[model samples]
Target: MPAGPVRTRDEVVTALRDSAGVGMGYVPLGAAFGILLVTSGLEWWWAPIFSVVIYAGSMEFLAISLVTGGVGLAQVAATTFFVNFRHVFYGLSFPLLKVRSPIGRLYGVHALTDEAYALLATRPHAQLTGPQVLATQILCHLYWLTGSTLGALLGAGVGLDVEGLGFALTALFVVLTIDAYRSAPDVGTLVLALGCAALALAFVPGGMLVAALTAFLFVLLGRYTLRRRRVA
Candidate 1:
């Protein structure tokens, strides 16, 4: 297949501008997370550290409570796995194969946020290159880091009551879900997700989110297998 377009100066500038817009949404959310961390009894510095190291978006927000509550390492590990397991499907279709360099591919995997994935999923795969992908991810990461650090500083210097800040993450996810559905409207996928969620809520009340996602993955794989067999 032909590489759709050469990376031109204009293309790079456009990509940067596009990514900057997406990154803007992260600023307030990241700041909220930072403020929440400090308010939750963690040192303000932990905000940036978690943003840079954990980089798990909503999970990082949950981590503040987890760490402060003295959650066990085993439980934390299990939660992280379940929360991030969807990335396995993301990797199957993401343009990581276009990333030629080993280091670039490694960073691409590490930097794969919901925002980044949503942005890429909307684009034609042939049009994307490693540099463009990396540029977008890096910009988003910088926005998160800067916003979190600034919020931490503000929290440390002059504390503010940031009630309901956690809702921002939920709002972001809702927006991303809408965008993804609009990009690729698949009724089967939607049905599978809803069914799994319902079943999980009915049966595995404690682990609803993880159980739903796991069941959805299995159903999705089964569907893919049937489709492939039909094609063959």
Candidate 2:
């Protein structure tokens, strides 16, 4: 028999207790998102709407520019797919957990943020349970929705501190970069990622992602070529 499922509390305090430290992280990130949304010309209501409807923070940011620049849906969708391609990998690790319902799977996709993944990934594999996962996802979405709306609402009153708030997204990217580099045991891969970042900084204008992906492929090819030569 499967080790039975865990239960989620039906209220806020329980959700907070379950979420632990992740809530603190979500607050500021959510605030920054709200500010970004308001500054980008989205109506205050749209802040919460997108936060709920799209729910992909980075993609939401990208969407703002896409909307303002008059980019079509096709281009916007392509960028979003490229940017979030890594989420596909998240599915691999937690693919067959205890999610037993269609709605749970639906919520699962909606709640698949970087923070949520990190939190759940730490659990002992078999020890993980359905309700706990749902709780984490629900709480995260709520926090994001609330924080984002608050920021946008506040923006209408007093406006955003542009310089300071812009750093929020930059900080997120830096943290992600550090985490990714730390994952590869080989220093060479780290160096390659950094070099690619620098090259993007130099040559790619609004094309940083394209550069990064290219660099990743280039590094892989170089590694393969070296191995093939040695074998030959």
Candidate 3:
């Protein structure tokens, strides 16, 4: 594929501005993860390693416990797969085609977090250049790395009991969801998502996230097919 257009100065600024809010969330949340990891008895350096290697925010937390508990490899793989299965759906609309360089595309895939998806996988940023998209992801990753490293260092020194820090992830998701809703404001899609969640909770509570995502994915494909047929 051809390389994407070179990013302009304005595009660079735009990417920075776009990632700023996500950075704000990531710093504290990553700090929470770092602090938890340190307090859980892991070395402070492991925090950055986890952020760099794992990069999956929620799964990284689960991984700390899994590692400390000595969970088996197969079980850990399964857990990681299920926890991040939503990324399959995320990829369906993640604007990756905008990033045309092979190297840029590879890193973009690796860095595709919820925050990046929320910021770039939308109409507003549809015109983002490859460099712009890559820059946004890079900035977000830096924010997370910095936050986790600082938190780990602090936790190792202070050993403070920072309860309720895990809730930062949930708070960040809520904010992103609100922003997503505000951007699109599609009542039908919102209602469908809620309905899918309700069904998943009612019938598959143990696998609610997977079930809900599956149901929503199928319903969305069905809607798309129907709309295409109507157009035809």
Candidate 4:
């Protein structure tokens, strides 16, 4: 079958094959989110709904608890913003511009999951065609959808301890973090991140994640500005 307009069969196959690694990670992680959501008292159908609509990896897991616990809109918004604050940095390197069409670009941005970002980021940006990028993302999304659906169906039939399930995303992040550091080791950036975390932990223990992310963002912006000035 044709992958999409302007894409060859070989390219489509390659994209699908490349996305298989992402699928491997996403399936289990998505399943964990699915199992946690259902076990937390949400309907099995809600699993697919969340996977389709939200698609925010770690945040989706947190949303299950927030939704079940009857969190207010304000709290949910604040929590979501803080939890996903790191995504802002993702846009800096994401190949969003490679996607030619407006609709494809829109979906590309929406479907830019951590797995997709990691997979695509490893590839040379100029080497990727719009269809290849979109196809890979779509395949990853399908993997997540399939996993979540199956997991929700299974959770409905049997009881399981979901406490450990939450670690799936964490483990994925750890692996990704290691891969990122190995690819481009930077002591200054590592030290900055650690310093931010330390300051957050010391000053705002209850809001450490938010404080750390906010501080890191500002520090990154400052660094970028300084580098730009030096370049000019």
The best candidate by TM-score is: 3
State every prediction's TM-score relative to the real structure: 0.85, 0.69, 0.93, 0.82
Tell me the whole-model lDDT of each prediction, alpha carbons only: 0.81, 0.72, 0.88, 0.83
| Candidate 4 runs further than 4 Å off | 1-7, 224-232
Q: Which of the two candidates, 1 or 2, achieves a greater lDDT against the reference? A: 1
TM-score result, candidate 3: 0.93
1-232: candidate 2 lDDT, tens digit per residue = 3333223443334546756555555667777777777878778888888888888878877777887799988998788888887677567666336677888988898789876776565455576667767777888888778878888888777887645654554565555445544553568876787788788878885777666766777777898899999999
Q: Can you write out model 4's per-residue Cα lDDT over 1-232, one digit (the tens) per residue?
A: 5455435566679889877766777787778777777888899999999999998887788888889999999999999888777677777888888888999999998898887888777667888877788888899899999888888888887855556666666677678777777877889999999999999999999888878878998999999999999999
lDDT for model 3: 0.88
| Candidates ranked by lDDT | 3, 4, 1, 2
Lowest lDDT 10-mer window, candidate 2? 2-11
- lDDT by residue for model 3 over 171-198, one digit each (tens)? 8878988988898899999999999999
Instruction: lDDT for model 4, please.
Output: 0.83
- Judging by lDDT, tell me the better candidate of 1 and 4: 4
For model 3, the stretches where C-alpha displacement exceeds 4 angstroms are: 1-7, 124-126
- Clash pairs, candidate 4, are none
